[model samples]
Target chain A: MVTAKLLGLVFFTCSLEYFSLPHLAHRLFPAWSYLLSAIVLWFIPIPLLIWLPVISVIASSCFFTRRFNGGADSVMFWVGLLLALTYTTADSKTHFSVISVMTIGFVGAFAYFMAGVSKLLSPQWRTGETFQWSLSQTCFSETFPILRQHSRCLSLGILLWQLSFPLALTHRYLAIFYIVSGLVFHIVNARVLGLSRFTLAFSCFYPAILFLSHSGDH
Target chain B: MVIMAIKGLIFNKRTLPLDLLRLFFTSWSFFDRPGDSFRTRLTLYQDATPILEQNWPETVSFKWWQLIFNPAGNDWHYSKQLESCAAILSQKYPSEDFLQSREFKQYLNHILKYVGPKSFDTISVLLEVKKYSANADFQRLVFLTLPTTNKKTFI
Candidate 1:
């Protein structure tokens, strides 16, 4: 169980995300910024790796205008910060692995909670109309296209899934219920709306939450 | 004690939490339908046709390679650019007072460069502050313009 490897994977993924769209960095810095970023994050060690997160946060804030970075980016930054703290510390009671795991759980649950609350705030969500609209809008499977044909049932199912996210914390069975629902929801998100990044970024948190769920009181 | 004091100062007015809610949540409220709610759309039109309508598969693939495979990225970044641009181009922008705003100019310039072809002559931004009442559908479309006083309206 190499903490560095796991954190490295997550950090590497989040950092190199810039390379795919070099135009983002090209706006802030020159063309060499992506190459410099790749070099620093990968080749450099802890003394320098600490700066990667700082640069990432600064770059993200500057690029996204300080208020609009999504929850996945937020999760990555928080974990990066924890990893940075993990680097400098003397390996006391608070280990980097433990803290990163906790951040994932907290952020994952928080994301779901906020999403549920966001859904509740919308009248369209209450009426299940947004689901109907989304179903029709997305380019999904044959089953989903047919699901769009029967809007009422699909809409209700979506409503139940969106609101049921909090049940993960209530009991073991309920937690599994929410977990399965989340998988299905994100699958639909990818298969339908083409939001596959969400599926990968968020799934990182599931194993931790699931382990916590199993260990917690029923 | 310091945490409590800071929390008291920020939460005393209750502005921070609501702002946080807006920052973290997806699109303030997902209620896109006509209502009392606030909705912002970064509608980009090129050659009189909408960008999304044109199908940007070549622009950026809708495939998994562009979506899930790229761990370091997602479409979230693109949407953020639009959201922030719309925020800067709020309805209050058309007023004479905002004409000299350097930040506004920068954002408008960035959005034009990011989305549309550089050779295109005109870039039009339409901000609709819509409020729906039981009696009437209240919608005001503010056509945002460049900082120049040239009187050449793109909209």
Candidate 2:
């Protein structure tokens, strides 16, 4: 359930950061935005995290489609949906939670799969020159400017990301390691590369991933 | 761990989830043109100061998170506009009126009001469109500054 709670917390934090800011005070009523603070209050690892409030936040986000910024926003969308799948039957936590974790894993893998496929199919990507072009951009400061310039590194990155999903589905310990590695990867992307939101948005799934991996050990 | 996973897949032969992921990966690999990753450009100049762009102060005053989830919130619309404008500009060179578009002005105002310094009355934006060509020449399109004197909702 740690994953469940973390999902909610990440969702709440994203909303708080983007939706409930004083900068948006005039647009979204301060009271309404302030009310989101309740989700923050309720983000504890309790058994019965309500779906309604999560739904409200998700709905508000959907209503404001202008806000969809990146893959991180897409991650928030999945977490919001998955939050609804949480069931409260007293039989066992593993039953629904396993399915929930698996579903998140599925979604996560699908995203990476598509990304890898798209890149593989592109001529620029195949030649690794696209990586060079992207890395060579004269835009904001890139985290790995020197590394990015090298097509081999970029190509290897693509291979690892696209190929790693199947590995995560294998053994319990291996899966945990894979997911944790994913977290580290995202952290580097965020901290060094400056793609900040990916850190939280992508890492929210690690709890589920870790739980699922651990479950098979028992 | 490796042995166990291999065993499950081999013995059980019913790794539906994993198989589906495999399928997803295989399917995506087929169509490989240029994948769009929301790589667009937005520039803001307060008299001569660029805000939140590459040419801004070299040290980068804000943190990574600040740059990613910027307070300005300009990426969404700015990106969409760039997409359509790229489509249009690729076919024909943009008109002077379109370059000085109302949408363009509104975006400028947004940057000035939210991100730019209030002290400077004159601000301008130079939008660079990337690769509007089918041949993938990495087409570059940019225009002169759309100047704004004050924040009072340009008339």
Candidate 3:
């Protein structure tokens, strides 16, 4: 229920922002569609109305393919869908919750691991030129000039951290460490790259990570 | 989706379903390397002379609100679209056919609306790709150009 609410809030925030912008919204759906979706999202906390928001999110994601916002949006959809499914199998709640958690956990872990591997494969990242070049291109270059000095070291550290992200699931302490590290990483990314949505979108998975890490205890 | 991803990776073929599924698990290869950044320019011509010239990022404001909302104008999205178009043009078809292709036409329509041009006789798009060197020296190449045409097809 907490995860669903957080996902709802995140969707509400994104949908409101997306639909409110006339230039962005009208290109895809009409104003009424956005309004209706927003209202449904607003009422997601209602026990009976949970499925409506999940459907809305999935539909919105499919409809806005060309204008797809980011991976975070998709993550929300998958997580929301699995969460909605969990509500359906009320008889086997424990088993279903485990399934949902494992699904989300595996997907989330793969994302981080894939990101790290992608960087590892990239020539620029391997040589440590990617960070310096990437940062130089962004608006942060002038303001955070000091980052350029140790760009290589910073890039290597980031690469290793991302590569080892899945190991967080092995131990509760490690999971806590990665969760905090990820939060800080996303916060920095939000500021440096203007990807604020990522911070909230990715943060939604932390709860699942915590659940899985602590699953063995109970 | 996982199966589709593995298939797409091996075959390099993607359907709409696969694309929609990809949003959930994108392999998160965004900016894996210092990738080539693309700048898109749209010029509306009235009578063989330029009337209004618009460039993305130049015309698109980098507002703080964009961090949470209105991310379509974000650098990554725009760059990815142009980069995809360039890749397709380079790999498969001729440039002229590609310009008339539905995929390209739809992209033009969307960008034109985003640019908010009123009216024009001919509108052309110039896609410039920035390539960076090890020494940080960069060069810009006109990667794609849609020759000026009075085609009402775009609008």
Measured by DockQ, the strongest candidate is 3
How does each model score on lDDT?
A: 0.48, 0.49, 0.62
**Candidate 3 error regions (>4 Å):** A25-42, A45-48, A65-67, A91-94, A136-143, A216-218, B1-15, B45-51, B59-67, B70-76, B87-92, B117-122, B131-155
- Best of the two (1, 3) by TM-score: 3
Cα lDDT tens digits, model 1, A98-191, are 6555555566777666666777666776675666555433333224557556665665565566566655655667677777778777766766
Please tell me which predicted candidate would have the highest lDDT against the true structure: 3
lDDT of 2 by residue, A134-156 (tens): 44322234446566567666676
Question: lDDT by residue for model 1 over B51-135, one digit each (tens)?
Answer: 4422211223345553445422243334434434554455557656454554444444445444543333334554443333444
- iRMS, all models: 8.9, 13.7, 7.0
Ranking by TM-score: 3, 2, 1
Taking all chains together, the TM-score of candidate 2 against the true structure is 0.65
Window of ten residues with lowest summed lDDT in model 2 chain A = A22-31
lDDT of 1 at B144: 56
Query: What is the per-candidate TM-score for chain B?
Result: 0.37, 0.39, 0.59
lDDT of 2 by residue, B18-97 (tens): 43333223333422343432233445556577643432112223464553344332233333444444435434646676
